[model samples]
Target chain A: MPEPERDILGGYAGDLLSWVMGRASSGDVWVTIMSNLNIVAVASLADPACILLAEGVELDDGVRERAEVQGVNVLRSGKNVFRLCAEIASLI
Target chain B: MADSVNFHFDIDGDNFTSAGEASVMIKKLLRQMEFSPDVIRRVSVAMYEGEINMVIHANGGTADVNVFCDRIEIVLKDNGPGIADVRLAMQEGYSTAPDNIRSLGFGAGMGLPNMKRYTDDMRIESEVGRGTTIYMTVNV
Candidate 1:
């Protein structure tokens, strides 16, 4: 069988939350613009490989602290949500 | 494992941020038990949706989970104003939640549908003026 896709970026907090909870595999990356602390909770529940905050948004201090405790890899992009998604799509 | 385990939690309806706490804890329990990832995910999503519903519609509720060898059963009971139309409520895009709820990134009418989607078996018992009970099972 062919290998499962890796590093594919999925966007939208709600849809991404659903997909991460349901469809996303263990190593897939999630890209979204939502900066709330709940994003960390969703990541913990979904067990995504990593999370990318797009649209040049910075993580809240609480979110960053929790991410450190949870060991969730988080990255930020200077681009917009749409542009980041497109770039992630190209990688896949 | 030959023994069955039971877990119970009180969901706080007033706090949206804490809605999914029970589900999150249950996920950890299942993982510690070495349940399959797929099974764990299904249970997590189903229970999370139920928890969210209880917080959003009902003024919170009680969640009971029974973990068996072959299946995991989740029961959510709420005393909130019961669902008027189970059929309409079951629809994918139908929502009675207010605008305030939508601002919180929920109220998209996907809660019930998502709960059903993630479970192997689901049953909803509701009385218009009384309350509602949701029973969902995910096979291990």
Candidate 2:
């Protein structure tokens, strides 16, 4: 978990990489169901606080390794995107 | 050219997993060189978009980053099916990427626009069959 204590200022939920790349703010908690290697690349460029993988999505070993190498914090939730966003909103 | 430091990478066309490696490297390099966070973000975002475009549209391409005292310049050259319409491609929500790429979370037509949005200047040179070359500069 890189920057474990970093404040989450906002949230963005998108499956489209380009859309997320353009709009996801630096400190936003990015929520998405897309699990791929490219997600790490996007996270690194966007510098999101963390990536919240909704819908109980799991990362493959290769992607997990990449995320670790890139120092991107990733979390998983069985709950859907809406609930995650709601929870994130309530907390931050 | 005399004072600029240049970095070059040959993007691999066949591997979707490796597409943005160059941009990532450049981002780290810029950070190490102590460029402002905003400048680093802008250059990396623009370069990342261009790298993805090359992988998606062209088979592969070459990316060149030149770091100078006042600005950073990026040149992307690809020998693939050229853009049919530069103006149309520049419009948001206008993408030619196939459904497979879209399924992977790209091809929404925001790549070119985002690149233009993050860079100070951008120019595109493409031919119907030969290739496409894009030049972009970000002010320091």
Candidate 3:
């Protein structure tokens, strides 16, 4: 959690990496169900506030390790994408 | 060109996990050079998409980044397989990538368009059976 206090301005939920990359804004809490190494790549490129893995999706050891090494803050939630987005919308 | 700084990298197509290494490296270098955050993000994101295209479409390729005072230029060259129709490939939702790639969260056919979207200028040179070369420039 390099920027643990990084401000969260909005939320974006999508699984299509390219769509997320093109639309996700900086400081946005990006929600997705995709758990692959490419998620880290997109997160890095898009500079999202943090990656919130929805629907209980978990990162593999390799991806988790890479995410940590890349300084990408990732959080896992058992809630589905809609529910998580709702919670994020309420909070931010 | 005399004052420009050039960096080169080889893309490893066999490993999907390592695909964006070059873009990440260049992003770090640009940060060290203190380029504007917007410029850094645009350059890195554009290069990352190009790298993924090479890894997913072409077997792999070479990437060169030339940083000048006024702009940053990225040149990606791949020899695996060239794009048949440049126009079609540039479409937002058009993709020729197999199902496995989509499962990995890519192949949404957004690579080329995103590259063009983020960069100031882009040009594609491809020969169907030979290879593809993409040139992109982002103004500083």
Model 2, runs deviating above 4 Å: none
**In candidate 1, what are the lDDT values of residues B1-140, reduced to their tens digit?**
66779999999988877668798889889999999998998898889888878888899999999999999999999999999999999997788888877665567777788889889999999998799999999988
- For model 2 the local lDDT of residue B100 reads 90
Best by DockQ: 2
Each prediction's Cα lDDT score? 0.78, 0.94, 0.91
Interface RMSD for candidate 3 relative to the native interface:
0.9
Question: Candidate 1: what is its chain A TM-score?
Answer: 0.72
RMSD of each: 4.4, 1.2, 1.0
Question: Residue B106 error for model 1, in Å?
Answer: 1.1
Docking class of 1: acceptable
Candidate 2: clashing pairs of residues: none
Tens-digit lDDT track for model 2 on A1-92? 76588778999999999999899999899999999999999999998999999999988999989998998989899999999999889997
Give the lDDT of residue A26 in candidate 1: 57
Local accuracy of candidate 3 as per-residue lDDT tens digits, B7-46: 9999998998888989989989999999998999999999
Q: Which residues of candidate 3, in runs, are more than 4 Å off?
A: none
* Residue A77 displacement in candidate 3 (angstroms): 0.8
Name the better of 1 and 3 by DockQ: 3
Model 3 residue B89 CA deviation (Å) reads 0.6
Candidate 3: DockQ? Answer: 0.80
On DockQ, the stronger of 2 and 3 is 2
